[model samples]
Target: MAATAPSQSAPLAALSSTATELDVRDMVEALGAALTDAGIDGDLRGSITLAVSEALNNVTEHGYAGRAPGEVHMVVDLLADRVLVTLSDSGHGMPGGALPPGLLPDSSGARADLPEGGFGWFLIHKLCLDLSHTRHAGRNTLRMTFPRYLAPEKS
Candidate 1:
């Protein structure tokens, strides 16, 4: 389905789909396009894409593990000074219903012994200015925001 149209005072984009790798990729791509259309690019755009992609991947892989894929809803808003993104799902909540501390995994071990995973949340935290998660009534909601980003002024 097409993404929702943006309004000056409303969300820049909104989309919903089953939580799957393909769908998550599509959502991320759509979001990137929306950000580009809104004159957002470079590092800020990269961070938003990475964080949102990781969150959606987690929902598909962990939240819906052993069950049918669940629905994931995403809304993005580009304010004058920041970008706000909210993702929600009716799948399993985070362990203990709390956000992960997002500490970087230990990398002092041998190359082969290094972690092959566990960096998603860390990267998300590092890129976002703020992050939050909540679970209530069997739904999980994740909210993240990034600092100002706008296309460079044309000469």
Candidate 2:
């Protein structure tokens, strides 16, 4: 039997998995495939993948305290003028004043400390058209968006 496409009106595709490094890679791959199928391309695909990976890694490393395994949920939505991705984790909330910086450097020169924790956040902000983070009901939700102009060209 052929696979069925998700409903257009639904506006989201979601999956939940235990917090694991391998699982995160798999999730990113799956999400990337879905986004590509939806016509997301150019730098947009790379941006989405990077942002999602960083967000998920944050959940595994900081949110879960790198000990107890928790659930990470990801949702992707296809809009007329943009693609939106939301990743949620059932782990500890972000620390006070732990938000990412507003500006990011275009070159590696701006990133002097490669071993630090700021690169992921910088990449997410630099790649996505918009990004938002929220903590609610004991979960952290990171939402990312890509504009239509950046989407992949249909074959």
Model 2 regions lying over 4 Å from their true place:
1-8, 102-117, 151-155
Q: Which candidate tops lDDT?
A: 1
Per-model TM-score, in order, reads: 0.88, 0.78
Error of 1 at 121 (Å): 0.6
In model 2, the clashing pairs are 41-152
CA lDDT scores, all candidates in order: 0.86, 0.76
lDDT of 1: 0.86
Query: Of the candidates shown, which would achieve the greatest TM-score relative to the real structure?
Result: 1
lDDT of 2 by residue, 1-155 (tens): 56646444665567788888889888998888887787776577777787788888888778889568889988888877878888888788778835667354445555574444457777777677777889888878888887755643222
TM-score of model 2 (CA atoms): 0.78
Residue 97 of model 2, lDDT score? 32
Residues 1-155, model 1: lDDT tens digits: 66655444678899999999998999999999998898888877887898889889999999999999989999998776888899999999888779878788999999999998899988888777888998889999999888665421222
